[model samples]
Structure formats: C-alpha cells, structure tokens
Target: MAARILIVDDDPIQRRLLEEAVKRFGHEAVTADGGEAGLATLAAARGDFQLMILDLVMPDLDGMAVLERLAKAGETLPVIVQTSRGSIDTVVGAMRAGAFDFIVKPVNHERLAVSIQNALKISALEGEIRRARRPAQSGLGFRDIITKSPEMARVLRLGERAATSGIPILIEGESGVGKELVARAIQGASDRRTKPFVTVNCGAIPENLVQSTLFGHEKGAFTGAVDRHTGKFQEAHTGTLFLDEVGELPLDVQVQLLRAIQEGEIEPVGARRSQKVDFRLISATNRRLLDMVKEGRFREDLYYRLNVYPIFVPPLRDRREDIPLLVEHFVSRFAAEEGKRRITGIRPDAVAMLSAFNWPGNIRQLENAVFRAVILCDGGELTVDEFPQIAAQTGHVSAIRRVEGNDAPPPAEPVIIESTLPPVATEDGLIGVAVSSGAGNDPAPFGFLRSLADDGHVRALVAIEEEMIRLAIDHYGGRMAEVARRLGIGRSTLYRKLKEYGLADGDDDDAGVAAE
Candidate 1:
C-alpha cells in the first residue's frame, strides 16, 4: 500500500527535496511551509497522512513548539525531525519534545528514506492497536494477535487448524504470556467466531465454589445462592469456554469437569438432573499438568482430555528479536490510552537492554515494564535510565558506571619487579609496562558509549545523567541544596540538571526508576 507523508519545513528548497524523495518511494507527499500551516493542514486532513517530516528551525513557531502544541491537541501522527548539521543539542532537544526520529541536515536521500520507512512502520503498528481497541461488535479476528515471532507464528498456525475441529485445546505458557489471548484468537478464527467466548480463571476462584462456578448453581444451592445462576459452560453454549490456569482445579472439580466434557452436559450443584450443553473447551495453564498428574495432584483422565491439542507459548526472553516490535506496540498503546502524545518510541540502547534481560514474568512483565516506562518517561523516547531493573538484571554495571563518570580499572595482577642497575631506566620501563597493561586489559568507556551513540543516542546518556541527579535528590530527601553539597556541585547546577533531565523539583519517589 502507498503511504501518505506530510513535510513541514519553512525552507522551500528543503521541502521540495523532501517531497521528491518521498515520491521516489511511490508515496503521496503533502507539504507545509511552517508549523502553523502544518497544524492547520493536519487538522483538516488528519486521516490522510501516515507520516510527517518536521524541520527543527522554522519561522513563526519552531519545531519543538509545534510538537508540544500537537501533543497538547492530542495529535499522535509520527514525526521525524530534520536537524541542521552539527546541531546535536537541538537534535536531543527535538527528541525530548517527542520526535519519532531525527535526520541530520545536508540530508542523505538514502538515509532519509530509510528513516521515513521506519516511522511509517511505527505509524502502521499504532493504527493496528487503535483498531484492536475498537468495539468488538464488528467482529474480532486473528489480527488481534500482535506478534511477529516465529514461535507465535507456529502457534497461530496450529491454533487456526485446531479451531476448525471443535475439539478441546489447551494453551500452555508462562503467566502473562497471553494464554487467553490465544484462545480468543482461536475463537475469532473458528466457525464460532461470532458466538460468545466465555472466560473463567480456575486459579482465581475458591475451591468450594469451583464446581458450582463451572457447572452452574440452582436457587438455594448454597448459603449465598439466592437466585439461579448459569455457569461459564452454560453461558458458553454453542461457543467456546476458556478455562484459565486449569492446573489449579482441585481433584474433585477435575472429575466433574471430565464428566461434563465427556457427556456434553452439566449438572447444577442443587439440580436433580443434568442439562445438555454443547461448547468447545480451551484450557490454559502456566504449570505442567502432566507433572501434576504424576504427582497425584491432578487426575490422569482429565489431563488427557485437556491435552488433546496443546499449544505452548515461549516466553519473551526466548524470543529477543521481537522486543523492538513489542516495545513499539506497547508505547503506542499506552500513549493513546493515557491520552498523552508526548511519548513516541524507545531509544535503541533501551531496546537493547530490554532484549538482553530475561523476562521471568514473560510478555506480561514486558508490557508492565513498558507501561511503567511510559508513565515515568517525561515526554520523550524511553531510555535505559527509565528502566533500571533491566540494567540491573542484565548486569550492565560497566554501562551504568560509565554514565556516572567512573573509569573501570584493569584486571588485578601480581607482579614483582627487580631493578638491575639504572634507576631511571627501571622506573620509566615500569611506567610503560603499567600503561600498556591497563590499555590492554580495560575496555574503553568512550568506545562503548560511542557504539550505542548512533542517531542521537547521546540523548540516552543525558537521560542517565538526569536519572543520577534524581537519585541523588531523592537520596537526600528531595533536598536539592543537600544533593548539590554531597555531589560537590553548585545548587544552580543541580537545578539545571533537574530541568535538563525533565524531572520536576521535589518529586521524591524512587518508584520512577523501578521498572514496575
């Protein structure tokens, strides 16, 4: 599909050049002379454009001001900043103002096109999330599964095949890996797509009421059972029933569930006879049902019934390649949900840190981390400082130390030097040996910094500095003067750091650094 792009630049020559480059990619291009004109054009044809190109320096409202205004107005169109040469400060400033990505001026057509393509991909992903949040009255489909990993793709293939048979299926994965999501995907893809997809968390319900919850209850079935209540199975008749955390179901409940599945009928807690009910069963669990059966915690017959068609979802750590796409998805999702357009995307270094860590809690953990970052992120690309847990989990001490202006010493060595005759020669030779050994053993912090410092990643360094200042301030009980005294810096310098880091004065919660 052809993408639509909007170019906002006061320079006529630059605008023409951008327009030509966008057309070369077979996309429709719209141009505006300045920020005001761009806003007016965007407001008029908001749905027409997929990406925006913004110039940092413009007449009658600069790029930062325009971006702030757009965010205030709740316009979330993707914007790539066009910065002048040697304008690192402006580039960082623009990024902090919510620019999607920035292109240094004296523009390279090849690089610009690549940047635009990436921004368009982000825009498309945001559009998908918006569609997912829409009312399900129209219909849900496999498109609800927002995954790009091979593991998920294979699971999806199996799910699609199993959805047609109407046989019982079990989804196995770590907690928060979206087991219910897979079940929903199956229901959406199956012949029962339009029918009700009832969900019940076996782990969340009390043991005493487990059977009643699944098999319905008659009036006066129990002390609190004042009226007749239909169970999840009955409600899901002619549709699909999703039993989450099925391993948590007690043995007695297991026998009843097995009977209901085999007979296609349910006997209410206080009823004399069974009522016929037909529905497909989709069970999910984070624990191993087979192991439970071996341990006598779960019944063997029930395990077999639920294991007829099992789907395993790998954790987020096993599929590191999908981290970037998932981060983009969550960023856009939370940004829209929170009604804040100040956040755009995560910094590449932060993405690297996320990819490196092991997500013990799986996709749910990652989602929570992203949401926490979004909430604490002060209107800019997310950075490593926004997620200190990632750095801690990944053992990125060297990276953190470098950010704190600490130089790591070389590895320890035991040596005894014997001086022969010339004192000057011996001293000089020892100094040379020490210098060479230090250089050989220790990695350069600047090199590590420079490697991740691509496309204005120096902004991440700024973020780290700001986080340090915030920590210092919090450590001193929001006392800026005390923090400045402890760091051996001036009070004004601390205040400037606070503003530079996008931290408000007197906000003392260290929760900002804790990646929820």
Candidate 2:
C-alpha cells in the first residue's frame, strides 16, 4: 500500500524536500505548516494518514506538544521525528511521547528512507497481529458483542434461535454493523462450535479468482495454478462457511452458489464431478439482495436459499445506547494491547460527545475513533481532546455521575427527580443522572423515557416516534442535519416529520433539507 504520510515542519523548504523524498519512495505525502496545523490535518484525515515526519523545533505548537497530544488521544499512527544536532536531548522527549524513530537535521535521504521503511513495516505488523488475535474472540459466544440496546437485544435473540437450527442465515446491515460478529456468535453457540469456521470475503477477491477461492482448484487448473488449492468451501466442510459481502458474487458464481446451497456440494475448477460437503451457511451483506435480484444482478434462486432466516443489524446511529458499553470494552481491550495501563476510564463529557454524534461508519468507525483516542489519551480518563475530529462536529456533553472504579456501568432504570431539567447520561464508570418528565410537580416519576401514560397504558408508536424526533432536535439544538443524523434518518425524512408534527425548523435548516 502507498502510505499517506503527514510531513509537519515550520520551514516551507524542509516540507518541500520531505514531500519530494516521500514521492521518490513511492508513498503519498501531506504537508502541514506547523505542529498546530499538523494536528488539524490529523483530525481532518480521520485515520487515513498512516505515518508522520515531525520537525522537532517549531515556533507554533512544538513537535513535543504534537507528540504529547497524539499519545494522550491513543493515536497509533507512527511518528518519525526529525531534529537538528543541537536538539539531541529533545529527541529523547519525543521518543517518550510516542515518536517511532528520530533522525538528525540536514536530512540524510538514505537514513530518512530507512526510518520510513521501518515505521511502515512495524505498523503493518501491528495490524497483522491484531487480525491474528481476532479468532481468539469469536470462540466466546455472544460475550464478544458489546451492547445494551434493545435493538441489539433483538438481534441476539434472533441469533440464538438460528444457532439451534440448521437454517441458512442471511444477516443484513450497513457495513461495520457487526454482521460477521453475529455470524460468529451463531456458529460458536451452534452444535458445530468445535468445527472449523471458514470465512470468505466475496468482495475482496478478484472476479477471475472468486471461483478458485470459493471452490478448490486442481493443479494446472489455470495459469499460475502450480499447486492444488483447497478453497474455502472444502475447508469449511462439516463446519460453517461465512461468506461476507456475498452480494458481490458474479452472476455466474451465484448459480454455483445456489447449487452448493441446495445440494450441499461444490465443484472445484477442472473437477470431473461435484463433491459432497456438509457445512452450515451464514452469509452477510450490506446490500439489499432483493433489490439486486429485481435489478437482474443476482440470481433469484440464490436469494431465496440465503434469505430463509433474515436478521437485520441496526446501524450505530440508531443504537446510541450501545456506544458507552462499546467504548468501555474497547478501552479495556486496546489499553492493554497498546500497553497504556494508566488509562482506566473515559470522561462523562467524552462519552456524551461520542453518543451525541451519528456514526455514519457504525461500530467499526467508533472502534477506530476509540483506538485513536486511547493512544491520544494523556490521563486515566479520556476526554474530548482525544477525539478532536468528533469534537469538531456539532455535539454536546450532558453532566453525569461516575460510579465506583470509574469503570462500572450505571443502573439501567432511570431514577426520577424533581430537578428543573432532565439530564441525559451515557455512562460506563462515568456519568449518572436522574431525569424528570413529569407535569404539575406531583413528583413525576420518569425513567430514561416514558413507556406508560398517565392512565396506566402503553404509549402509542406515533407518540413515541414523535417524542424521539423532538428530543433529537432539541438535543442537537435544531441543527436539522445533526438532528436527522442522530435520529438515524435522512434529512428529507426529518423534514417530513417536522412538517407532519409542526415542529420548528431549528436554525432554518429547511433550506438545506429542501435541497436534499
């Protein structure tokens, strides 16, 4: 991969030289004027940039300060600091602040290239190690999924049911919504728990190789086929085969897939006959297969075979309740992995800030955010400083109470209070709060939300939906874009509701909504 490197320096000449040197090494370079600008660039990139080359001495936001900020926020991006001969002692400080390597000024192009190579090598190795360790987690059924939301609870219930039967499961969700996690949970909890679990990313493989990847190929099956290869299907025999992004399969491959599902056999390339193989099928996708079928891009027979037991995983924005639990879980895991033992908890404002924004990338994005934050974190508790990109977005922090250990989650039931206003709390050893939604000061009893009416009956769906929309609008200060995002709906959908319920257009965001 061509690494995107951020070159931070005060001197324009130095920046230009470094950029040229990076291009010569076949890597992309992004230059920042100073340390402050460097930090801003990092925030804007959202983990796209892989490495940094920092100038040790700068008038504005010195290199040391940049490293400190990066270390505190759990930023794992490798840093290679460049300094002058006179500033040798400061190089040690930079190292302690998370600099991957250091080089002297009047840059030796060879030395800079070697340092860059080592930094990229180590970064790639770290990522590889993380992936190697994932299997260690899939063995633990349902425990690996961190969630407190009812939306997720429903998913889990469906997964548990699927585990008991031999039905083919089709898990639908936006990318990064943990569809694979749910698949693993089903396999782990099933009768085939000890059997091999083979996974294939249909989207990642080249079209020509998809057939050979899914079905074993005989030696000399095609050019570059020097050795017999056991494809994913044979490897998954008598166990489970998880085909991720299954919708990406070519039309021809879909026919074979449908055959395999119906007959429990797969034909490898250059094979004389199809071989019988028994395996549980669990497929996942971020696309609408029905629509694809209607568009004649997918085989209708294959779609029905896969959609027998459909389970929809809600996106992160729709399940804000899960963010705190997931944050705490990731903190505990990444802190140990990264050796940041001092970091134990996250600030309530930080949790609130995380909860307030709609994560378009879902859990994967949030996980990356927290990983970066943990590396950037400077203290025991993570703060907004650690999440600069998310903090830059329109969000607010609701004051909350932290419990013992600053690590335990608060009670689920909201404690009612006679306070002037309600406090929304998102906590895990962080903030706690009591909400008040009562009328006429009769010591109104309220939970995080109201489920029952004054007449002791369940509330109507329309009333609940309207209330949720209004609360989202109020919480986001009428920034309709934000309100729509946090509510997990489109701007157009939010506009329709505002008109339907006669809600005020906060900030007159209607112009933007209308354009949408």
In order, candidate lDDTs are 0.74, 0.78
Cα RMSD to native, each candidate? 19.2, 21.2
Q: What TM-score, computed on C-alpha atoms, does each candidate reach?
A: 0.59, 0.53
lDDT at position 267, candidate 2: 97
- Report the lDDT tens digits of candidate 1 across residue range 1-516: 246788999999999999998998767899999999998998887355778899888879889998999789877788998878547788787778888998888889899877886786567666767677632642355655766678887998998899788889989999988788888878878888878888899999998889888998999988999999899889999988999999999888889899989999889999999999989899999999889999999999999999999899888877776777678778878876776576756776677767766788888899999998888888567876667565544534333343334455444662212223332212112111111111123221211212222242233566446545654654456666677888899866766666565565454333322311
lDDT of 2 by residue, 288-368 (tens): 999999999999889999999999999999998788767866776687689886775677657767777789999999999
Give lDDT: candidate 1, residue 121: 58
Candidate 1 structure, TM-score to reference: 0.59
Point to the candidate with the largest TM-score. Answer: 1
